[model samples]
Target: MDKINALGALGALAQESRLDVFRLLVKAGDNGLPAGEIAAHLNVRQNTMSTHLGILTRAGLIRRRREGRVIRYAADFNGMRGLIGFLMRDCCGGVPEIVRPLAEDFSNA
Candidate 1:
């Protein structure tokens, strides 16, 4: 992602509810969760959750699709990859050892 897009994603995640929402959607994977389900899981009101979802969507951190009358949200994997790539671009000044732990963590995950 470019600097502006990265900043937008970071800013969207800076909020507690939004962060929780994003993490939950990420965990849900491609199948995602419906809007009401997300709000219920987070103990948030539907309107509030909708607002949060809008911010995430605009930030390119999540995507939404309609199924009947329901809207399902999922993490945008490409956007996530772009953000990670942007953050790790330097990679500890090209020292492989500095990023070994992170690589191991990803492998373990």
Candidate 2:
């Protein structure tokens, strides 16, 4: 991601509810969860959850799809990868040991 997009993604995650929602969706994987289900899971009102979802969507952190009358939201892994890539660019400085922890984490994931 570019600077603007990275900033937007970071800004979206800076909120408590939004961060919770994003993490929940990531756990949900590709199947995602319906809007109502998400709200219920987070103990948030539907309208309020909708607002959070909107912000995350605009930031490219999550994506939504229509399933008849329902809308399902899922974490956009590509967006996540983009943001991570931007942050990790030139991180290790060709030193493998410097990023070994991160590599181990991804391997488990």
Candidate 3:
């Protein structure tokens, strides 16, 4: 991920609702959840959730799929990985020890 794209994803997640939505989608895994279900789970208005979803999609942080009359959303794992890579590209100035713990955390996850 280039700086611009990374910044865009970061900006999209800067908002509380958007962050919650993305985290929820990530936890939902590959199956994802319909937009209405997501909204209901988050206690957000349907129209407002729709707007947040659009922003996340444009930022490459989430993906949308149409199933019949419903639209489901899921975290774009590749995009998330790219953003994380961009952030850790120069971890601890090439010191493995400093970065080892963080890597271990991800591995445990």
Candidate 4:
């Protein structure tokens, strides 16, 4: 990803509510959750949840789709992968050991 896009994504996630919402969506997996369900799960008001979802979606960290009258949201896996790639693009600076733990984390996940 380009630096500008990466910075935007990072900035969006820098907020507590947005970060929590993204992590919750990621844990929810590809099936994701509806807006109401997400609000209930997070104990947030529907309007507040909407705001958080909007920020995440605008940052390209999440996606929203209409299912009947409800809006279901899911983490953008490609965006996540891009962010990870950007972070490790120049991993180790020639020393592989520096990134071993990160590789292990990915493997375990």
In candidate 4, what residue range of length 10 has the lowest lDDT sum? 94-103
Identify the superior model by lDDT, candidate 1 or candidate 2. 2
lDDT of 3 by residue, 16-68 (tens): 99999999999999889999999999999999999999999999999999999
Clashing pairs in 2: none
Error of 3 at 6 (Å): 0.7
**lDDT tens per residue, model 1, 3-109:** 99999999999999999999999899999999999999999999999999999999999999999999999999998888988998888887889888887887677
Best by TM-score: 3
* Number of the candidate with higher TM-score, 3 or 4: 3
Q: How close is candidate 3 to the true structure, as a TM-score?
A: 0.94
After aligning candidate 1 to the native by TM-score, how far in Å is the CA of 37 from where it should be?
A: 0.2
Candidate 3: regions farther than 4 A off: 107-109
lDDT agreement with native, every candidate: 0.94, 0.95, 0.95, 0.90
lDDT of 2 by residue, 14-109 (tens): 999999999999999999999999999999999999999999999999999999999999999999999988988778795788877886887688
lDDT of 2 at 103: 66
